[model samples]
Target: MPPLIDHTTHFIAGRWSAPDTATFPDRNPFTDEVVAQVAAGTRQHAQAAIDAAHAAFPAWAAMPPGQRQRLFLAAADIVERRAEDFVRLLAAETGTASGFARFQIRWSVDLLRQAAGWGYRPAGDVLRSDTPGRFAMAVRKPLGVVAGFAPWNGAFCLAWRTVVLPMAFGNTMVLKPSEEAPLSAGLVLAEVLEEAGFPAGTFNVVTHGPGDAGPIADAFFESPHVRSINFTGSSATGRMLAERAGRALKRIVLELGGYNPLLVLDDADLDLAVNTTAFGAFFHQGQICMNTRKVLVDRSIADAFVEKLAAKTRSLPMGDPAAPGTVIGPLINDRALAQVRQRVDEAVALGARVVTGGRANGRVYEPTILVDVPATAPVSCEETFGPVLIVQPVDNPEQAMSEALATPYGLCAGILTRDAQRGLALAERFDCGMVHINGATMAGEPAMPNGGVKDSGWGRSGHYAIEDFTEVRLTTLTQGALQYPV
Candidate 1:
């Protein structure tokens, strides 16, 4: 059954308009079906969204911080109230399982709550002065207008992460959501703000295509109103956006692709390690950026670990995401499916062994595992962005760490070890931005910081993501006047 298309108009200035000849159909990847039709916003609409955001920024930035915080809290409430609907719609659009869909909905709510805390907090620091009455302090303030470039994977969550913080900090936004799955969920997220009495233009969703993004980004960069951009997507595209943002000297918070690693030490609990790795690496059909792509095991336990991991992966549920007990689902589309297949085939031809699953049917690629993979194969070096794991054996932790950090990508890394001190030590040595001890690389808590380094991307998310969306301005309030540095 096809999901109903809700909220088809471009949401600008707090109203919806199905502008003439500016609408597009949004399709579901699971069945290659058009589930929703929404406005395919033009460059004109993008300009309008930016203009509206610019017009509203001053008032929003000047509003009482407490009031802004309360508004965001209310938005969080609305999000929670609509959780079930959001999960269902998200599953339909992105082919995410129930558990993963629920996680996305919950994370969005948590991010809103976290962002709310930043709203009223005095974003300033006091400085010690050399002279009496020479009071000096620096305060963090909202960046005027924000352009949020969201991708299709975890679409609502990514959009929520980008916008909630910016909005909470009093910056209005022109959000360009991915055209692949812009329907009920993401649109409804923007609606919650409007419904919660947020002023029109404070938040606007500009519906458009990938091609449309270049123009929108260019305009936002040129506009004096836009202050920053928060983007979550591929490194190639992220680099382009970062370059443009840099040219404008605009701030950017980017969370890009990953070829993250999961290291299983000899002392680790085999059952726990196998279970977590199987689920973590294959979840969402390996579409997640943080999914464990490479598994480095201590040579002593390599064979046993692979046997258990392969069996666990083979048992994972597949097919319809909406169906109960379905742990795996189809890739986003035919392109993604083909990419996964080609990578697996090429890796095998280059001396990698497919211990299990290297097949594709339509958009569904079997949860696959490849062993003895060369360090240079795309499966090992690049972000396959599919349900495939490459396993390699190392003689010791030193070798494991060395091989793990061999790739230029360093988004996230996971270590499973019995020794706490060893885990912490290894965590510090890993080149990635975030490290996980005794768990899969995909593990994330809404309250915890997330992101990566190197080619994996820049910036961080989670509770502190709001800090990236803002700027600091120093202010001095002196009673009866005072002094000079010179």
Candidate 2:
């Protein structure tokens, strides 16, 4: 067993405040062993974090952009140096398999490096003026005191994503990480920033127990110091937060749930399709928001595709996340396990064919594939955050696209076809925010616009996030005054 981690204090104003008497246990999902004791902060702590960020905003934002860039670069180096420790921490806190943990680390490093370049980009642009001898320009300025909520599924990567870009654009942030992964998703980030010599109160973190987020959220929504908010989590939670943010008249960016789809055309490479589907449906046990949930295959290739995918799913290794060979690990908790079981069992009872797995072995639910699932089944329409895939046959490409657009989610979609032109044409028709040709739905790049539409939520991440975190102000100077009609 690894040594237990103890971080039972809120990080406020660049220092770790005294430990909170009320604490919560963070457990290893596979073994149910307590991995760390995290502080359970109250509304007061949340307010203090916001206040600290507000106080530090002007100086931090006023600093030279090049100096800020260097700090982010140094933080990236620190994270890279502590890679092994972070791998273990993720496994212990969130049951993240070695491959996924490493992927998170790699992307986080990339994100930091990418964010460092933002300082060099033009913050605004010159505008044409119709009046003679007039100069006009539009400039971007950071919003003050951004409030961020990070989810646990992609703990390390999402936590970095939630705050890094905004901070890079001269904004200070107060983060509230998921209780289930406070150390991996919250304090570890604080440690890196501290080691990199970030200014005091430039970033703050407040953690709460599972059912205790209400107070913290209330504080974030009600505080006048909080100018904007960002969240990565379920759609249900995002809706609640959006309502509060709207009432408070604050701007918000949300990356919520997704019932992503993957289309397999008849002319697709069968080998590549099967390989991509298996990875997309089962990676990290399908807990990712981008995980493929529905697969629409041309009727002629449906049987062959299902057979190959089921075999591949069954062959995946599942066990302790600490093992490098394990591909599928335990769900976050009993509730997640129960939810998967209930959805799979309910679908089976409703006459869906279970092509491969439909049972649980302790905390690990086996990778499951269902064919001919009824449209009315909850698993067919709802976002099931587990290792489950629903397959359906479509007669033509039009029907396939129709089925893909039938959902409330518009996060992302994938198309597998031999004809790149046809794939691109179809990609253009997708109402979602992102589409990939001959690729899996689980694809992402740090420089690309990452976000969704409709019920999947609005706003984008990566290079595009700056637009949401900053305000545009137009300025004009005239050489001579002109007569005005009053």
Candidate 3:
């Protein structure tokens, strides 16, 4: 057996400090075994982390751009070297299946490499001066301290995304990872950065127990040293944080819940559409914010599409995440499994027909497909965040687009059609931030402007995130003394 890893101390100010509050067992969702002993951080720890980041900000921000670039590159290399360890940790800590774990590792490496190039990007733009003998420019400066809250579902990649770009742009960060994935989500990044020779206090991580996030969030919002906040989680939590951030007069970037849609037009390739819908709706057990929650198919092809998709969903393997053939793993906890059960049961009671799987085996909810769900069903409108796919027939392409737009969520949409021009035309009508033609809704890249609109939350990720993490200042130099009209 591999040696057990211990993560019972918080990484603060470049040192491991035993928690003042307590230590909690981070358990494997699949086996119910202790994966690690995680430190339970208090509000004081959160404040200390913020203070350390604030103290480290000036030197990190002022360091030569080349140096920052080298550090990011080194970190990427470290992540690549430790890929297997990350894969194991992800499975043990967050129930991440092998395929998704590998994807996370690759995406994290890409994010780090992309962040390395950010240091060399143009930091300011030269502007044409309106006044003679004057030079004017808009300079982007790093925010002093950034507070990041990363979720457990996409622990490694999402956590890396939360802090990497902002830190690349020269801001120091204090990350508060989800209690369910403290090790994989936050402390692992801290380890990589520390090994990559990041300075003391440049990146800090504090872990809290379940239901104890309030103190840490309070600390983040109440502290004057924290300049901005970035969060990835449920829409409800995002709303609460947005309100708090607003009251505190701090800038915040939120990537919240998504009821993403997938449209299969009449002319869509049936095989491709079925495969895309199955993968988009069931991959990672449909826990991803970009997972297809609602599939709108043209009535002419709806029956065929649903039949193929149901077969595909039923064929997916569900078992231990660490197993080579497992495509579906246990939910994060019993609460998640219960929520999935409640939603599917309620929908079925309200006239939804289960086309395929709709039962729970322990912590794993079977990959489910539903049809004829009523509009009033909770599963019809809200995000199920499980392996539940709702297939609805649309009269035509126009009705499909209209049905897709009925939701408050505007995170992402996918269009599967053989006609490229038709797909493009339909893509233009989506209110989502991202629309994929001939692809699954589960899409992301290091450089893409990945985000959402409407109730899915505001702001963007990837290269666009720099704008949210930094501030712009207008600077001007006068070649001669200014003439004042008195």
Clashes of each: 0, 0, 0
Give the root-mean-square deviation of each candidate in angstroms.
2.0, 1.3, 1.2
Candidate 2, 295: how far from true, in Å?
A: 0.8
Order by TM-score, highest first: 3, 2, 1
Question: Model 1, range 373-395, lDDT digits (tens) per residue?
Answer: 87667777888988999888889
Candidate 1, after superposition: displacement of residue 365 in Å?
0.6
| lDDT, model 2, position 292 | 94
> Per-candidate TM vs. native?
0.95, 0.98, 0.98
**Winner by lDDT:** 2
What C-alpha lDDT, on a 0 to 100 scale, does residue 445 get in candidate 2?
78
Quickly count the clashes in candidate 2: 0
Q: List pairs with backbone clashes in candidate 1.
A: none
- Against the hidden true structure, what lDDT does model 3 obtain? 0.91
How does each model score on lDDT?
0.81, 0.91, 0.91
Candidate 2 per-residue lDDT, tens place, 179-222, comes to 88898889989989989999999999999998999999999999
Report the C-alpha lDDT of model 3 over 353-465, residue by residue, as the tens digit.
99998888878889999999999999998999899999999999988888899999889999998899999999999998999999999899988999999888988888888
